[model samples]
Target: MDFIDEHLNHIKDKGLYRDFKFFTSSQSKYTSIDNRRVLLMASNNYLDLCADDRLKEAAEKAIYTYGVGSGGSRLITGSCKLHDQLEKKIADFKGAEAAIIFNTGYMANIGTITAISDQEWIIFSDELNHASIIDGCRLSGAKVVIYKHCNLDHLQEKIKIHQGKKRLIVTDGVFSMDGDIAPLDKIVELAKENKILTMVDDAHGTGVLGDNGAGSVEHFNLKGDIDIQVGTFSKALASEGGFVVGSKSLIEYLRHKARSFIYSTALSPVTIAVSLRSLDIVKNEREPRVKLLENSKWFQAKLRKLGFNVLESKTAIIALIIGNAAKARKLSEKLFEEGIFITAIRPPTVPDNTSRLRITLMSTHNRKDLKFALERLKKAGMELDVI
Candidate 1:
């Protein structure tokens, strides 16, 4: 207990202590926090479908038909028609042979990585992959070699240095923090040349990238090239759960080997119904995705013009580096006071001395909303000397 207090104090002193903001309203471009309507600029609901009528209707219908909870795991009585349908739909969407659903994206990554690799396998991972992917690599007992973030030459060098009969190259399609896209096409080329399997966790890319919004794989036109593709419905899809799509053998193997999937209770039928409906909506509705990316580009440029250190990005996520943790937190607080809500990302989420404001845009954020945010950010940045 004394050690716990010491650790808490250390983090607090470092401005790395995190707490939650209770939202009284549904997630969208604007939400109620502490009864005050705040412009939300930190959400991952890229398509802005979290509170969509269609998704709500689907959830209600599923609830009426299938009740609430999934009473067991997937292999047991929990597997329902909705679950099977969603898996099939996801497989078709990603152009994979089959797909398996997990309770969360974290579970999907952790389960898939650990299920596929062992001490004999060497996993070449991107340095900036999600924590879930990192945790998966740690749990897998594989020799995890981290290449420079999205640096192909470094990855290639590592691949050559650590030759293995069973090897995998895993990366996030769009990095969640920095918002930069991975060179999946080049990665695929490297994988093929080196005879290594490839996996892409397109959690941030799905429903927000490519011509058809099929994710970074589609953006790179490398469909069916990746051996194991992982994604989640929690972000852009505006639903719940995570999934892995690949060959039928891979899916079958995961069912038997992935401990996270085998033991966890399946996602609720309601969530599955919402995911199914959202998937249909996202596939057809291309305008929102277009507007979202366009807005991202426009907004990031505006921030840079205002003298903020905005990171270059192709997705809806943007990272504005503030460099110091306490200053970053102060900037976030100043923005909150101006009716804008952007989370200040700090160490371990990012490297030390690279604290940043993780600003994410929703499809519903129009020019007016963005302008308001810009004005507030400008004022806050001036006050906090962040610009």
Candidate 2:
């Protein structure tokens, strides 16, 4: 009669149990997966900066200087010299008047949205916004209206309908599931006419979009117009932690009023150092983004040529849509056996009948590796009767 056991039983029946894969080596183009050397296409190490020597050295130097771990919460004792320096550098990189760091991208979204808005604010969110944004809306107790994903017409209609209320418009800079981008330029114009505050969670967009990976805000040239820009260091940055970039007043308000930032232990000195180095690496080495785009375009075009249902992607995320969850899982397993690695995304992560084999590319993968993956994909598609 317990609800927990009932859900567990249902999950077991559906073959939907989830667990982590313990990697015995650093993340890279290839990994020691399930006792076999497999080509890794599932990682978020987009620009292949995770294994870069600069970041490694930065962390090592910090550990030598500041020791391991921040011992207390930021407000009481954990804000180290490195954390302050990192924040300043991030602000400069993001073109924000100021920036504040947080423990994770999830907490940054959760804490900031909750801190800045309240029940009286009407939060208009994209239908496909990430879970963190959804949870943030709930925590804020805001009257949330969901607009169809990336449909500016629907968004505009909702804006006009809800004209009298204090409004906040939020969206994912790059929607994680489908690999498509938000119409930020039009969204900003709509926000301006309606007098709304705008926030974008650029977790996957930071090191993938714009002329040189400056993110969605920069891609749309809305640097100062965006009320908040939340980003993660875990993806293209190849590090950990999150930051909110905005005006000095907003940054200061979150620094003091955001409970998650106030109560949580600060990012360790080594993490701060690694992220700082990543910022340098991402900006100074522009070749990775170029190579990344080439790799993604190659795979996407080939997948379509082979008749697989590859979703449209402008960034590093690519998805092969397979309608049935069981079939999607089978496709992933078959691909793994063929020495390719990918993740199978299913319901709740996406809607029903929209299961997909999510493939992410890195700049480290070469042309031969690219051709090898395409061959394996063709074989897998043929075996699954998908082609």
Candidate 3:
């Protein structure tokens, strides 16, 4: 097949092409697109800290001091005092012995999984695990076993089958599409009994769960038992980066052997500085997270009262199951037209028949916005016949 023809044929056959909008304003309740301002319900800025002025000032200060960009990879020239401090700060925040930063969540997961796993190790992952984790498992060359989503018994069965090999149980703290949390305590106990290592990608959990926003590990009070806590700054931290926290030796090993970290440029100084400041904000300004949780609870309650099938979650993610790709997309576009912009997730991002509207909440959204969102969603639901 000719190159352009082949690509065009693929797009036409699968309906996979997508176009993105450019936002001209801060990622808050309202975003500008096509010269129209609409309420945004699609961003992962859970805490609404992404465009915080203090953090931006910190980033600007960092740029003045360190200049823009890390000129080389961390192993060669990008490693800086700021990076070391950020790592230490993250370790302390997450109650880990040490931490190491990565350029992105995908790199962090892939690099760690590939670097530490071996043939003798079996990577037991949940069926609904993120694509990054799936790719990581493939890179590890370890035997990958898929367990049922949040089904402890099924996971135990897989563990039984792979018992002979070293076990590495991996799961996402918050299932992105389903808006459900993992059975962490159950998984932790099972792994301990089986002497298996455990890894959790808390990309959505951090800065949204637990008292101090320490995430799932602290939410379950399973300190030191769970082996690794992988997180990203792009979500709650309002910056662009990722990191993995573990024991001192484990992080040191990653520093030496995680090819993604060793070869890829480190997170820029501005990002590190901004994340560090955001951490402080999460630690001290407790009211925002408190409001965030309150908003989530109220929104869920309102959705149920309005006869919408809002998926249950202890975090900021709310998934309204629409079940058909075309219908989901239509509903999302309708919501946007109604001035409540939500993202419609369809097949491949989810299973074939489980398309949904992924509505995320932020502390900045008050009762008025929530009420308006609920109204618009109800209207969309009626239009799509999803309710």
* Predicted structure 3, TM vs. truth: 0.96
Q: For residues 93-157, could you state the per-residue lDDT of candidate 3 as single tens digits? A: 89999999999988999999998997777999999998989999998888899999999999988
Off by over 4 Å in 1: none
Q: What TM-score, over all chains together, does every model reach?
A: 0.99, 0.97, 0.96
Q: Model 1, residue 198: displacement in angstroms? A: 0.4
lDDT of 1 by residue, 220-256 (tens): 9999899999999999999989999999999999999
**Considering every candidate listed, which one attains the maximal TM-score?**
1
What are the runs in model 2 whose C-alpha is more than 4 Å off? none
lDDT of each: 0.95, 0.89, 0.87
* Top of the candidates by lDDT: 1
* Candidate 2 lDDT by residue in tens digits, 285-324: 7788888988888889989998999889988899899988
Alpha-carbon RMSD, candidate 1: 0.7
The residue pairs found clashing in candidate 3 are none
Any idea what lDDT model 1 has? 0.95
Clashes of 1: 0
